[model samples]
Target: DGSGFLAIFIIGMFVGNQNTRKVSYILPVGEGITWLAQISLFLMLGLLVSPHNMVHYVVPGTIVAVVMTFLARPAAVLLCLLPMYFRRYSIKDLLFMSFVGLRGSVPIVLAMYPVMDDISNAQLYFNMAFVVVIFSLLVQGACILPVAKFFNVYAPASVAPISKANVGIMLNDDFDLFNYKIKRDSMEGRRLRTLQFPKETAVVAMFRDGHLMKPQGGTQLKKDDILSVIGVESDEIALNAIFSQDKPVKQYPLYAGDKIYDGHTPMTLLAETYNFELTSFEKTLTVAECMSYHLGGFPQPGDFMNLINARLVVVSLEGDYIAKVGLYLLSEIRLKEHRRKNARSGVSTLSKYGQKSLHR
Candidate 1:
């Protein structure tokens, strides 16, 4: 029986440590089964107990209770825990542990075994077990917290959990989950590929447009989307910056001869008008490779792509793909115009000074 119990415990530990992704999905069923079994066991034991017979063994039951609480439980804890260096239980902790060893109605069930076997003195033993359980439950169980506090072994209350996704398993302290609501204009229409997330961070799931979505690299995050982010403790700053709800700006079509924009003109036209060179590039790579201002791969609309001293905006998309990109040389044009204006002013000043000298 002991070997079989040990084998079952080992199997349980092995199964618990394996890939537990399915645990969240199957928790309701497992919890229901456990609750059902416990309820059935207690209900069966409740039917077998007789309250009138319990009073006969009160004196012997109290003696057994005192010995079990003060001697047996503490001795078991010291013998089992003190020898193991890894589980160094302090005196105060052991005191609290011993105080909380309340043998509830479980002993009552065990005492029934002798009665069922037609053993002599079974009635007396059962009554004693019942009285001991009542004393333990009414006294030790009630004073557990006070005993912990008196020993200074009570732990502080932990921070409340933010996620509603509850499975019965405890998570490792190394990992944590963060919840963020992508506010309007913040992360709106931005693809996951464009964002440079940290190595240890991952967007496990997202809620968008009233639907749950398992996001991938190419997935575009919309405004008001609730993201379920998982990351290590050290990556909190990076995660907050990525999910920040900054105000949105109007994205215009940055192209040549575009009538919609009043002040901002096309890059090529601006360059021609201002007499500056407009550099360009043609290449194709995965969206994952592309960044905020690069042209080696397909980029999202309104994203700036840079080249040799020129810039381009991804003006359009071809059904989840980049179709056309608008080129610009605005900075170069402004620089050239400023230099020309300075030269013209210098020349005008020289001409005026020469005319004045002639008059003098």
Candidate 2:
């Protein structure tokens, strides 16, 4: 416990890796503490610096900033990540990682020591440190995304889970808060008392037209209304079945060459056919319309949509509408299982269909 910072780091890692219950409980408190610390640190550092005095050392400060940004930081990153050694990381990845070594409030905070001790070149060093921090925050920080994209390290688009509930409250680790928009026509216009949610799950709060109301048995739900409920994880599927507009596709009787749709199917059918549980927003829209809605206009070939548990690429287009959709399931275990099952049965199923078509 010589350094409180090191002790905190160790404790954080221990709790994060080993104690799921403790982690969930402490996460809110830890976040508040972290934000308060960050704000206080920046405020103290700002009060300690003098902008007019910094201008006098601008030349030397800028030179140091250039060296740190281009050489020193990159060298440190490459050396530390040397274990990657061309196996997993390529040159572009290394370069991008190096470019992102941003200096923050910590370095500026450290620089305050020299000024307090009245050491030689103290003011100049402080000024240079301040300059480097600004350069990192303003310049390097801004370019981080673009640079990552250039190196192909950026993640693809997907349905983002903004928050689990209207107000995330973990009561005793026995239940989790799940936020859902009332989408299914069946659930809309129904009273909370009549719907009969699971015994363990309870709707804690409801948001209607941007207003938060504590839900009671008499509360009636409508489309676009958001409900934050606390429930056990195992009961989630049952809850989703009620509130979600999307229905699970029956895996039974699905065979190769089987047409899922004989006529026009909603674009969202791609989700059901591919075994994806659609997000509340993904229901009802045709594939073409969904694409256009998401992409800001008509989606062309190569445009992709990321749903909660699935990824879709527009494989083909028929005049401004999506004709063929390619689904990429995000779960590795599920993907392998599906592939194995389909490959085993696909050959026989296709042969039967092919024989009938040939005879005709």
lDDT of 1: 0.56
Flag clash pairs in model 1.
Answer: 267-328
For candidate 2, what's the RMSD?
Answer: 17.2
Compared with the true structure, all predictions reach lDDT values of 0.56, 0.62
Tens-digit lDDT track of model 1 for 145-208: 8878899888654322245343234544345577777764756776664566677666677776
Which candidate achieves the best lDDT against the true structure? 2
> Could you estimate the TM-score for every candidate?
0.47, 0.49
Candidate 2: tens digits of C-alpha lDDT, residues 120-205: 98877778888888877887788888888988889644222235532234433456678887766666556554454676776666
